[model samples]
Target: MMILALLGVLALAVGGCVCVVWAERGGPRWVRVVATITLAAGKVVQYSAKNRRRGLGGSNSADD
Candidate 1:
């Protein structure tokens, strides 16, 4: 349990550090936007690598 808690905290800290690093760097707006997108899409990259995950299946149902 203690090890799991430590890992979770470590993950949170690392993620926060990444965000800080991303925000601090100076670059063009497009570069920043691309960086943000890349950072966000990183998690989904595993699915792409496996080529098993799918998309939303044409379900554009967004209730605002």
Candidate 2:
């Protein structure tokens, strides 16, 4: 479950990176800002899960 959660985050990151680069070419300022925030939030959530898996929480291993 943890891995799945992190996978979703990573998938978003990959797709978002592509979109952001494309947006940089011609999209609006808000697109950049929104994408940046979305990417950052995904990363933060992923890291939080990772930390939880490191035994900081009662959660299962990220490998699970």
User: lDDT for each of the candidates?
Assistant: 0.62, 0.77
Best by TM-score: 2
Pairs in clash, predicted candidate 2: none
Off by over 4 Å in 2: 1-25, 56-64
Per-residue lDDT tens digits of candidate 1, residues 1-64? 9999999978865765566466668755665665576566665767676564233433434321
Each candidate structure's TM-score, on Cα atoms with residue i matched to residue i, is: 0.38, 0.49
Off by over 4 Å in 1: 26-64
Model 1, poorest ten-residue lDDT window? 55-64
- For model 2, how does the per-residue alpha-carbon lDDT over 1-64 read when each residue is reduced to its tens digit? 9999999988977877776786778778877886787778778989989987777444444446
Highest-lDDT candidate: 2
